[model samples]
Target chain A: MKRKKLRRAEDLFFTWVMRACLMTAAVVLGLILFVIFWRGIGALSWEMVSQPPSGGFYLSQGGGGVFHAIVGSLYLAAGATLLASLIAVPVVLYIHVYSPNGRLANNLRLALDIMWGIPSIVYGAFGFALMIYLGMRASLLAGIITLALVVLPILARTFDEVVSMAPRHLHETTFSLGSTRLEFLGVLLRQTVPGLLTAVLLAFGRGIGDAASVLFTAGFTNNMPEGLLRPVASLPLAVFFQLGTPFPEVQARAYASALILTVIILTISILAQLSISRLGRHVIR
Target chain B: MEATPDTTIRPLPAKKIAASRLSRWRWFKDAGARTMLGATAVIICLLIVVITAALTARSWPILSAYPLAELLTGQVWQPMRGLFGFAPFIAGSVAVTLVAMAFAVVPAVFSGMYLAEYTSSRTRSALKPLIDLLVGIPSVVYGLWGVLFIVPLVRDHIGPLSDRTLGQFFPFFARTNPSGYGLLAAGFVLAVMVFPLIVAVTEEVLRSIPREMRETLLALGATRWETTRCIMRRAALSGTLAAIVLGFSRAFGETLAVMMLIGNTPRIPSSLFDAAYSLPALIANNYGEIMSVPLYESALMGAALLLLIVVLGFNVMARLVIMRLTKRS
Candidate 1:
């Protein structure tokens, strides 16, 4: 009876410890999101969204909005997404249909895997060097190219997987019926358009959220983007530079900005996941 | 021709010629697509060459002027005056990473093990998505959080500890005001930023352990903890280690959060309260500010090259470990 009681006590203790671990994990995730949202929403306002950031807080001097940063972030993300998709889609399609043989396909896949493994900072360095060499000083075009390079591997890999998993019989039948390569591509692309869009959205989310690579190449400028070749501010960069200072209201604004950025990223990720599952369900059915 | 045998043949001008022309064109298009595919395969490889060339070209001036030892071993990083030793950045990067990893690994791995080995299916479903949300949160957001909530707490509490301990002797510790923008704060924020990744990867590895082993251990009258320790944990050690390494790499490469939180002061961390810098942070801060045809430019590029090499080295090592494990498994 004594031994059994001891064993039971030990088991109960371990179980409770394990339960606490689980609880902590859940709480950690919850707290991170909650803190961001709580602090961020408190500082957010229409005026804050409409004007460019200036020197003082809203409660005191009516601090400016993140309008320029938002626009710049959107422009850069869109530009990078467009460039990456333009490069990745054709490459992914070719790898899927034309390069079914071992050497070409395997090499491409390995290149992408390596690229994915490469750090974002390296991409920034390369971008800075390349841009400087080309006589472009911290320009938006440089930022776009840098982000596009970093995202290319991710887009290609995801698109390639989706396109390959697409109905093979459709391709075989089209080929046997003497349809041209372009026709086959058109049909396959139409079928996989949603999946490809999801890939682009994921890349856009990553690009917009990324700050380090953009920091060197994008160079935080407060002015609105005059053109593709000019420097511009971004949401991530603004939060990064502003949050480190000693002011309370500035910090609050930073929280709001951070909250906005996180929301955008989370929304895109959730949407991507939903589309992936939807695609999976379609394939299964 | 066989179809024509069934009825009166319709007259056509050069039917064989048209078929041949069509086949030739189809072949050409196929060939073109194949060529495009091959070109895509070469693109990344080509990028590797381009980057290497650009970096080496930029570093030529500094390398020609200074010996390799001075560049690696010198203490100061005065790029404007042609001094280009990145030891401070290197030390700062290492110290911050070490502290962050120390804070992150234990809690993350324990949580992962608990989730994988202890939790029920319903619980998993409810909690897993929440954990993923942590991973999806942007680094900039984490930076903001650190700046606002965490920095103040550190400043008010932990910063005083350093002041109390080393108040008389060390000037650096005396300067330990509760700014929350220092190495410790950055390290904690990095720990938070990387926590989800470590937990998720470690959990997946732990979950992959076969149930039969655990069942057998349990049937032998071992408790759940005993079963996990003797069977599941032992089996997943290498995988857990790999997850740790991967997490380390993520923390190492994290630039935005660390740069923002870590007071970008290029000095060795004399105390936990002291501020420090990191390689990626330094690059991000100075790369834009440096001008062309200057020693600062070369030094920055050189540091960047070194950082790139280090990150690449870690990735290669991680991949190698993964490959060996795969072969063994």
Candidate 2:
């Protein structure tokens, strides 16, 4: 009876410690959200979204905004997502439809898994080296290409999972009907459309939020991205550069940019989750 | 061409029959789609190869100019003086990663255990999304938080407290400058950044344990704590180790946040309060300025190559361990 009581007490202690760990994680996340919103809310405005920073805006007081950065980020992320999707979709389709259980398919998946774990900084270095060798300057093109590389593996892997979850009988039936491989791929695509969108959105979120990968390649500019060869500013870099200044207003703007970035990411994540559930309902098994 | 009566009836024309056969063959033989996707797959594989080759070719100048030992082991990293040693940054990276792991592991493991063993399905579902969101938060935002909140708190409170309490005996906490930007602050931010990843991996590891094992322990009159401590913990040990290794790789390659908080000084830090540089930080900080100098770009590329090799090695080992665990489970 005494030993039983001691065990009960130990169990209670273990449970409480675990609860505290959960509480700590929740509190840290809450603190981050609270701090960012509190610091940035006052500086967010329509004018801040519409106007670009004037000269000496980092140091001097002025009514300026991150319009350039916002536009540049959108363009860069959109371009990267498009490029990644163009390559990743075909690869995933090939794996799922053409060679579902082949050695080549498995090896490809493994390679992508490794690529997924690579650090963004290495991607940046690779992009930078390639640019120098090709005599290309820091421009929107360079940033897009680098970001595409970063997002490609993620998009491909996610899409592969979605495609694999498709009912096997669906493929067998289509093949039994004497459908061409392309037509069969078309059917699979229809089944996984929601999942494909979620993968693209997730990739877009990653591409937009990343800073280290594009820091050297993008080469920040004050103006919006005018052409493929022109330099572009992004939200992450904007926050980095603005916060480095010694001015209060600029720092506030940096927080606002971070707030913007956070909201975008949050929205994408929520959408992705919703689509996953929606797609789950479509799964036969 | 047969003009007999049965042939003249011509139930089906030879050309029409040939067309149907060709269509049937088209269903099974899709050379166009096959080649297209096969080429796309090849391109995907080539990306990794190209990146490795590019990094190697760019780093060749530095590798040839300076011996590998000298580049890796030399203490000073004075670029202007043509000294390109990576020892300080490498040490800094390892130290910061170790400190970050130290802060993150306990809480992560506990939380993971709670979610896996103690919590209801509803509670687990509710907390899982929150953790996922935390993982999605940008590193730049984390860096901003570090600069604004963590740095000040460390400088004003933790640094002074450490100095007063541990200064007499421990040299690691003895020299506190109160600058707030050093190894400790960087580690704290990194811990926060990597917390979600560790939690996710650990929870997965714990969840993969067979229910029969837990039931056996409970049936033996073991309390919940005893069952977890004696049986489940041992079962999931390898997975938890793999989780820690994966998180360490993440912390090691982290850049912007560490750069903001680590003070970016090129020296081996003797104390947690001292400033230090990391490999990624070094590359990010110097890439713009090094373009004007001759072997400087090569040296930076060399540092990047070293980082890539180290991270890849860790990732491969972690992958193998996880694969083994999954196979066993």
Candidate 3:
């Protein structure tokens, strides 16, 4: 009886310890969110969001905002998303429709998995090399191309899973109806549209929030993005530069930029989740 | 149905139907998609190849100038002085990654076990989303948080406490200056950043174990702790190892957070308190000014090449382990 009681006590202790471990993660996340919001709220203002940085902005004299960074991030991410989609959609369709369960498809999946694991910094290095070879300086177009390469594998793999989730019978039924392969693909695309959109948004979220991948290719500028040939500033770089300075106000701006980045990521994540559920209703297991 | 059958007595001409189906637009539509998709696949493969080729080509100048052995084994890394030994950076990378893994492994394992074996569905649902959010949070945000909170906390609290308590016995804990912008700070941030990935992967591994095995262990009078620690954990050992490796790869390749918090001094740290430099951090920190010097770009590219090779090696090994585990279970 005494031994039984001791075992029970040990079990209770173990359970509580595990609970605490789980709670620690939650607490850390909560703490990060709280710290960012608390530190950044004061620095946020209308002019800060709407206007570009004025002269001597990095000195933390507080005469500038993050409009240029925001616009640049959006433009780069949007352009990359569009380019990635053009490649990813066809690749996904080809794997699932044209050559299902073939060696090419399997190899493609493996390649994408490997590519997905490559660090963003490596992509930046590769992009830098390419830009040098092409006699191109840092420009919006360069950044877009680099980001597209970074996100293509990600978008392709995600859409592959989404397309694969359609019931096998759906494909069989379309083919059995004497419809052409193109029509069958059209039906499949319609069925997975929500998931495809979610995948694109997720890739966009990743592209915009990333810093290392674009650090070399984009080349920061204080002005708004003027043309495809000109350099563009992004939020992640802005945060990095601002925080690196010795001035306190610049650090505050960094926090505010982080806050904006966090919001964008969270919003994208929530949207992705919502779309998954909506797609679930349409998907036939 | 009977009316349609009677109407079908007058059939359409086969030649006309064939001609319509074989129209240029239809044939083009049918063939165009395959060509487009095939081209896209080729592009995907070509992109990966191009990246590899570009890194190698850019790195060749330095690689050809300096022997690989010297670069890997030399001590110093002064670019301006033309001394480009990557040993310090390599050691720094390994040290910080090991420190982060040391801090992160226990909590990640326990959290994974809790989620996999103990939690109710409701609690799991609530908690999983939060963990997923952690994975989505950008590294820059982690860096910002580290600078704002972790650096000060470590410098003010942990650094002093460690110096007074453990510094005497273990040199690893000793601090000369204790500014807290060093391996310990970087490790803490990396630990937090990688915790979610480790937990997620481990939880999946544990959950893959058959329910029957778990029930049989419990029926044989094993406690829940024994069942999980002895039976389930052993079964998933390879997978857990893979998870650890995956987390390590992430820590090794991490750039922004480490750069921000690691007090980017290129030295081989003797204690956790000393500042260090990592390959990725070095590349990111110097890429902007790299073009000023003749061979500086090549040297940085060499570092990047080393990082890429190491990260890719780890990823391939982890994927293989995962594949084997999946086959087993």
Decide which is better by DockQ, 1 or 3. Answer: 3
Candidate 2 ranges beyond 4 A from true positions = A180-182, A278-285, B1-25, B215-227, B230-234, B327-329
- Model 3 chain B scores worst on lDDT over the 10 consecutive residues at B6-15
Question: Model 1 — TM-score against the truth?
Answer: 0.83
Kindly report the docking quality category of candidate 2.
medium
TM-scores, each model vs. reference = 0.83, 0.92, 0.92
- Give per-residue CA lDDT, model 2, range B140-240, as digits (tens): 99988888789899888888888889977898987556688999989998998888878877887787778899999999998888888875458888888
Give the TM-score of chain B in candidate 2: 0.88
Q: Which ranking of candidates, highest TM-score first?
A: 2, 3, 1
Report the lDDT of model 3 for residue B178.
67
- The TM-scores, chain A only, for the candidates as listed are 0.86, 0.93, 0.92
User: What is the Cα-based lDDT of residue A7 in candidate 2?
Assistant: 83
- Over A1-285, each residue of candidate 2 has an lDDT whose tens digit, in order, gives 998888899999999998998898888888888888888788888876887887776884776888899889888899999999998997799877777667678768767876877889999999999999899999999999999998988899889978988887787777666566676788888888988998998899889988889998988988867999999999999999989898888889899988988888889899888988776676555
Which residue pairs overlap in candidate 1's backbone? Answer: A48-A65, A51-A65, B155-B178
Using lDDT, give the best candidate's number. 3
| Residue-level lDDT tens digits of model 3 in B1-329 | 45554321111233332466454455457568878887778767666677777899999998999899999988988889888999989999999999999988888988988999998998898787788788888899999899889999989998899899999899988986567799999998899989998898789888878788899989998788878887545788888888899899989999999999998888888998889998899999998789788899999888888988898888878877765665456
Between which residue pairs do clashes occur in model 3? none
